[model samples]
Target: MLLKNPQILYALFLLIIPVIVHLFQLRKFKKEQFTNVKFLKKVQLQTRKSSKIKKWLTLLARLLGLACIIFAFAQPYLPETSQSLKKKETVIYLDNSFSMQQKGKNGELLKNAIQSLLTALPEDYHFSLLTNDEIYKNTTKQELAKELQQINYSSNSPNFKTTYIKAKKVFSKHKNTLKKFVAISDFQEQNLKDLEFDAQLENTLIQLQPEKNFNISIDSVFVKDKNIENTTVQVNLSSSTATDQLFTVSLFDHHKLLAKSSVNFDDNTKANTTFSIPTSQDIKGVLAINDNSLQYDNSLYFSLQQNEKINVASISDAKDNFLKKIFNQDEFNLITTQSNQINYNKLSHQNLIILNELKSIPQGLANILSKHLENGGSLSIIPAETINEASYNRLFNALNLSRYQKKQTEELKITNINFSNIVFENVFNKKVRNFDYPKVNSHYYLNTGANQILSYNNGQPFLKQIKQVFLFTAAINKENSNFKQSPLIVPTFYNIAKQSLQLPQLYYVNENNNTIEVKVKLDKDNVIKIKDSSKTFIPLQQHFANKVNLTLQNEPKSAGNYSVIANDKTINLLSFNYNRRESKLNYANLSSYKHIKTQDSITNFFSQEINDNQMNFFWKWFVIFALLFLVIEFLFLKFLK
Candidate 1:
């Protein structure tokens, strides 16, 4: 019972005037001579009783009516008991991810939600809006209308917990302020799961459901097989409903359609279609399918470029026939340099640097190789029969690799391949138990702690890697070991060189941390830029001796084939697509969470919030009371006499 205008209560003092008039107007009952004295006495007593009753009732009603008018002007109200003192603060996280392309009753989920918010919210309504890639703080809906219209499906994938922490920072630190975190999304299962709410803040999860019955998504595209004549590309597809399992998939070379194929998903969630095209020509390809579910996943962009030969540099003056046979001239630019003939400046240009049976390492050569490994090149060390352990250990310490303790005469068979390593992934069809195990007659006892790539039968590592640095304990010379002739030598050495120059893939997911390696020679002043017609920006790049590593954290936000430009020259084409994680129509069950509420849309939530029961104004009820008191006074004055 609080008064809005307590100063209006000063008018209550005016009621004293009516009381003074009632007292002053009261006159002594004048005794009048009448025809009958007894009759006059009886009538006088009755008249006095009736007049006093009517006067007192009229005064009571008049005083009440005046007081009610004053109270009505005061405009008192009862504050909300739920959050009487707390000021509400709303923070909204609108998920503009690729999954929001799904259509609902009105239109696309994102567009419909945006329109509804603009319509429901007032122009001066203030709140913070957070999207996956950008944040708008303490802005009004009128200002947000223009920004919201410009939002596209973002490639930046943000989990719920991470977005929550980022959103919570924009709220006020006052304990008495009530905070509300509203997350509006399609609530895809990959993005939001097991959301634990903060006790101090209120939460709302608004899930926009699509009305469409069926959804088809282009899962991925990869090279199935390739030969001199043709390259076969496999495009994977998936669907939510069985009614539309079969879809026509088209392959395109930029805008020109190359081939068309139909894929039937049947009962399985996954199906693939293949297209054959000439392998000799570089391809800027796109795999497209007609699906109404999500437009972003309907087409996947990819590219293929001409192969570049890997440069291999060997530092040895010994017999080079075995090395020459393994690294042929067709695929490798193999150069053998002696210890004295080494050019330290050009050593980092090679994709792979081989120290082939170096009896003693020069301090300067070891130092250059150390920098080579740091620049993301590959290094393989084949120790000699007798070596300087002290100099080798110095290189080892610089590379953060284990040291060679001492020499061992015990012979060991090189068995056990770490097939799970990224180098051997998909290289082996099945585990081979029986093979000609390479043997080493004498080897150094390499000390502990390295990722063992090829281990001996006794579990001692024959070959191991420490961050692209390959070390073989036993020398692979014809006199010391027969590992030079072993079949394991080809893939073990080739993958090391291939992985060093990580070529751009067929297509990369833009929602992932992808490092695309481009083979180009650029001066220190130059940089690389990836651009299409609509967007152009420089990616985070690190230049080495021969190539540059372009780390695509989040660029080319849309799915398309973009050109890699160096010094205004188009050197290569890199393709990026949105991740297919949002393609599947899976959602989280928000009912399991106790602290948050589930709503259909922000429009409905705003309606409920505007009509809060906490604002109970007493002014209207006071007006009604003033009218009733006036009627009571009228009835008393008119009918009581």
Candidate 2:
């Protein structure tokens, strides 16, 4: 026991003043007859004995009253004897990751643990709760309870290192007070190994252990055959125990089961199965295993769309065999045009048009190509081997290519090739080879707003871009180099033409005069452009990172199509059809309670324990004692009278 206010001990000095008054106060009696001297002597002896006893009793009562008052003034409390006691400002860290949704006997193990912690809280004790989702600080009981109820398991788990750093900052604010941390979770070995705990935290980890049960989940699903119109969807399943179990795998199209198959898994074994689904129509479905596990991975959702057709047109001299061999396939519409008979307006409708070894674009062609792009078309330009600077600059400026100085002829070989989504998915399917071409005398090297896709041996860009248009200035004609004879000739020409012909999906604002709200997911360095009929790219009134809402400079005269392009890849036109799945949510029932116990080595200063028997009285007992002392004083006075 300890006194909260020890200064009250000075009240003992008041006892001396009471004692002095009692000693000084006296009364004188009149002289009596000699006959009564004997009786008076006997009475005097009795009176002296009574006086001594009463004096002592009065002093004892006063002392007792003073002691009681001092004890009351100095508030005292008992401490706990246990060593593993917690502090008053305890911080509880709860894991709310998706893994915590694993069912126990009663329900979610995390839910049960939280409920137990709430039930065990003492009225005088206060605590704060943090979770893997977010931390709440200095909150009231009602607020904490409401936040707890609002918490749901999330797929994204918080990084332990980040949480530890945040916890350190929060704990540092209360350095003067005792602090304790309690982490409640499954404590899976995988999750624990990556965690770095702060050395400053006085913490205890509680691992909840639920009953072990067998679980089988769909590990992965993918299309096996790329060319086959009817695709094979493969599913892989795994189980913990080696019991031969029969399970059903179902494929659903818009919640309707299109196909179902039953398979048996040998005890403690893995299985792989395939289901054939026709790729005729765009299909979205899932493969589900009939086992109790995490639901997110149980059913894998996928979407499949049809491939778009690519149209290409090539302009070359009648004797150009390289262009002839590359576009020989039926998929390409190879058009040859002489300098005199070339009609540039007809080339606008084609997805890709190539100007090979051209001295100059016809009078209205450059402006026409710009209008085609503004209307959502792609173009590729291959400058002639021998060309003047004025002619080269005319084509370069039209494609937004920066000005450059010409370099002497050198044997350039394709060395590095980039495999972007445009190249791998839309163009060549990872089949590209090196080819040598004679470096031109007056070819321009791009400086800005251009991405070098393929580089030569000397680190010069062999294939580069200027906005949506692609330019390949390397020698392909027989006069300059033997590139026409190489095996890479067909794939290189085919890929370049296909990429240039692609067009962006047209996006139209519902109301042209009003604010046009466009929702798109964009990464850094991506440019968004809005254009008018004159083919001028206009900057938006306000540019945002992700979502954009801006008023157009002018109202559109008619309801037609607007163009949108990103990183040179056109959005799939068919994907614009809006399709959303609406189904009733099926929530699993809560499981039973899981037992977890945690221990800490540090002592708990706020621990409540019953102290051993000690000499102590309640305030009521002291009041009764005071009343009894007053009664004794009254009886003594009456007797004296």
* Best by the lDDT measure: 1
Residues 262-337, candidate 1, lDDT per residue (tens digit)?
9876767678888898988787898899987788888989998776778889998466677787777756888888
lDDT of each: 0.83, 0.56
**Candidate 2: TM-score?**
0.64
Model 2 agreement with the true structure over 464-512: per-residue lDDT tens digits:
7666677765545666655566554565667666554332222222223
Weakest ten-residue segment in model 2 by summed lDDT = 575-584
Error at 211, model 1, angstroms: 1.9
**lDDT for 35 (candidate 2):** 79
